[model samples]
Target: MLQRAFNKYIDNFRGFSREIWILTLITFINRAGTMVLPFLSKYLREDLDFSYNQVKWILISFGLGSIVGSWLGGKLSDKIGFYKIMIFSLMTSGIAFFGLQFVTSFEGLLVAMFFIMVVADMFRPAMFVSLGAYAKPENRTRALTLVRLAINLGFAAGPALGGLLIMTVGYKGLFWVDGATCILAILIFWIKVKEKKKSKYTDKEHPGEILTNSVFKDRPFWIFLGATLITGILFFQLFTTIPLYHKEQFNLSELQTGLLLTLNGVLIFFLEMPIVSYIERHKINKLKVITLGCLAMAISMYLLLVNQWAGILIIMMLFMTFGEMFVFPFSNSFAISRAPKGHEGRYMAIFTMSYSTAHILSAEAGMDMIRLFSYQNNWFFMGTLGIIGVLLFIWTMKLVKYEPPRNI
Candidate 1:
């Protein structure tokens, strides 16, 4: 039975093109190597002795940079092709990571962080657009899940390794590793994945197309983006506010917090593909799945209200992990599907921008709430925001027509 189950798990990964696997490998290498983000808040607060307000602003700068990067990546991918954009973004960002360790002053760090993120996040939309060229439409959702699985696998390894690096060599070590990995990942991709010529979209390629309207004028998609922004805010708290809370509330060490985060990555790595495959097989409505994910995240926040037990942290991570598993893959597939043929980069860029915007708000808002009110109150606020996201998703469902996945 165990062997059969393992075989079934392996079977879920079948049918992807060789390029998809290579992309997944590149993502893993990059994400695993770029481990600074999960610990950036902690490094700023404890290592540099930055004030909470200073940390918040630095994080906001990071987000603002991400917004610009996403927009640029998408637009440039449409113009110059995703191949060149991916190479440039990763190579430049990798070099920047090496220089970042020297900038310790609050003002200097803010500027440094912003520029680094601007370069780094440009990889996101380019990567998304590349998937459109690489994966078959019928298997797009599964392919996305496969890439996400790689990301989670990298996350699972990165935090634990980052904790050890911090203990032995201090935070400086993270920069060198992150920089090296970005270059390494991109080099591998440059060698292995030959760029394909862009394909033109036609009526037969996408029948009954709803994304025929201008992207700015797509009301349902805008509402969906709003919901995505809210959920992204809720999700990003895992990296920002939640880590601080782990230390302050439970007196967990950096290693302990890293392990807790590793659990989130581990769960997603093992379970997410199967879950996504199951949903696809059942022909589930993507919006409904997204709404369910929103509710799960809200409950995870509310679970944090039980501050007495450290075990509750584990429970909270489980809910948050499952929520992420449900939301992100479907979200990617949905966003890509909504794009008009030639404008994939533009559509994906806007979709990715929602998360970048969320990152800015998540850190600033979370810190403000913690400063003004109690942690419990902050949790209450996040939970309420998640509920609002759920409602918005439901409203979006009413506004947009759902297209079942095509066999072609």
Candidate 2:
């Protein structure tokens, strides 16, 4: 009887699992390659024999490619089919990763990054669409959290592992690992995944451009976009100026710096669901929750500007993380619920682009702040931007006529 009960439990678990596990595994492999990302700027300058201007151009080209790919990916998914588009894009991304092995010059690197990012970005938008499609609305947040959990686990391991590989096997060997994993992800997904076709609800949206094209004309999306632009300005500063602050101001070792970031990811991974539960139970409104999260992120980044030891910074990060947990998942869930039915792909694409655009523009501005005044000014500038974001979210609540956001 106990054995029979165990078999029944196993069957029930499988029934509930869905294909999310496969998707998570694929996403894990992709993000794991990101371990090499932190060191890339240095490599571009030192090993590739590129001028500073050339390296800047390469990064710009990569961002531009993602912009292009995001738009195209949404379009293709709308027209062709999400699964087919995803599979092909994932395979191409694996090829692009392999291409990294040969690139030796600025021009070669630019071309390689262009293709790599284009394919990678394509997969992300498709993944968003897939998540939106497959998960029941009530379970969506939990489902997406699992995806984040898997990716973070990969991200957590990637940097430490990449650092090891770079020292022992050299940089090229790390690139090999990146390529091989992408291929492995593709193979695993191709054999195991099953996709649900969108019914007539999708058919109406297609040639969806007629409806989607004019979607910009609506003032609500514009207001949300404005709010998002400011929010992006605040959160995106971490990638650009935060590391320099650690090194120049705090004098942290490279490993210490990497672990700080890993901690942020780890906090987000372990605490998100509990944090989500806490935020939901709080009597505060959704807008308030989002504002608080943005504030926490902004303040923490600002704290780095101050003279502090490692312990202080880590503590501030923990405080900021509490807010981040509430903001990202809840904000995304609220936004998708507000989207016009069947337009999830387009809505998410625009939102994701906010982050991409912020990263590119902030890099130069962030470096300039550190150069002219100090790295502290980088946080000062971004924190002010975040304050403005908080007000914009408040104003959006007053201005937009949509139904109130359902959850905190």
Candidate 3:
């Protein structure tokens, strides 16, 4: 039975194109190199001695840059191609990371962080559009899961490695390594993946069928974006408020905190693809799965309310990891599927922007709540937000069911 299960796990990873695998590899390299983010808040608070209010503004700036980057990346990908945008985003952003270590003042770091993020996050929507070009319709969801697995794998390694770097060489080393990896990942992609014009292969799997409806007019999609925004806000706490809580509440070292986050990455890495595969094979409703994810996230936050034991941290991470697994892959597939043949970049840009917006709100709101009330109150607020997301998703499902089919 163990052997049979192992074989099934292996089978789930099969059938992706070589290009898809290469893309996954590139994503892994880039994500693994991103050691700066999980530790950014801590660096600002402890190393740079920034006030909580100042740190909040800096992170908000990061989110603002991400928002603009997502919009520009999607728009330019549609105009020039995802290939050019991907290359430029990575290459320029990598160079920017190197300069970031030099910016210590609050105002300098704020502007610098915003500028770097603007370039760095442009890679997101472009990469999504590229998948639509490369993967078959039947395989798109699995392909998305594969890329997510790479990201989780990278997350698993980045933190543990980042912890060691901080202890030995300090945070400055992180900037250098992150910069190098960005350049290296893009170089590998440049060498291996030739640019393919979208006109050649887009929508060929279903000839004469294109979703031409304006995304702004899609009521279900707007409702769905609301759900997405809520979940994004809930989930982003892992990076923003959660780390500070680990130190303040539990007295865990950076390495210890990283290990807890590593657990999240490890769980998602091993279990997410299988879960996504099961959902795809069973033809489950994507929104229903997303709702379940929101519920899981709510439970995760509530688990944090039990702050008596360090063990609760592990349990909380588990629930949050499962929530992430349930929400993100299906969300990607749903958003991409909603796009008209040529307008994928636009739709995906908006989808990614919701997360950027969430990042802004999650950081400032979480910090503000912690300052005024308590960490416990912040957790309670985030848990309630997740429950709200669940209701929004259910409403989205009803809207989608009654909605007339779009022209193909």
Q: What is the TM-score of each candidate against the true structure?
A: 0.90, 0.87, 0.90
Model 3 C-alpha lDDT per residue in residues 1-408, reported as the tens digit of each score:
999999998999999988899999999999999999979988999999999889878987888999999999988887788999999999999999998999999989989998899899899999999998888887898899999888888887887799899999999999999999999999999999999887654555542244344576778888889999999999989987998999999999988987888788778777888998888888888889988999999999999999889999999998998999999998888888788767788889999999989988888799889999999999999999999999999998898778665311
Q: 1-408 in candidate 1: lDDT tens per residue?
A: 999999999988999999999999999999888789879989999999999889878987888999989989988887788899999999999999999998999999989988888888889999999998899887899998888888877877787789899999999999999999999999999999999767655334543353356487777778888989988999999987998999999999978987888788778878988998888888888889998999999999999999999999999998998889888998888888777766788889999999999987897789889989989999999999999999988998887755443231
Better of 2 and 3 by lDDT: 3
Candidate 1, after superposition: displacement of residue 260 in Å?
A: 3.2
Q: Using lDDT as the measure, which candidate wins?
A: 3
Which residue pairs does candidate 3 place in steric collision?
A: none
Task: Report the C-alpha displacement of residue 237, candidate 3, in angstroms.
Answer: 2.2
lDDT of 2 by residue, 111-172 (tens): 88887887778776678778777776655665666677777788788877888988898777
Return the lDDT, model 1, position 86: 96
Backbone clashes under 3 angstroms, per model: 0, 1, 0
Give me candidate 3's TM-score against the actual structure: 0.90
TM-score for predicted model 1 compared with the true structure: 0.90
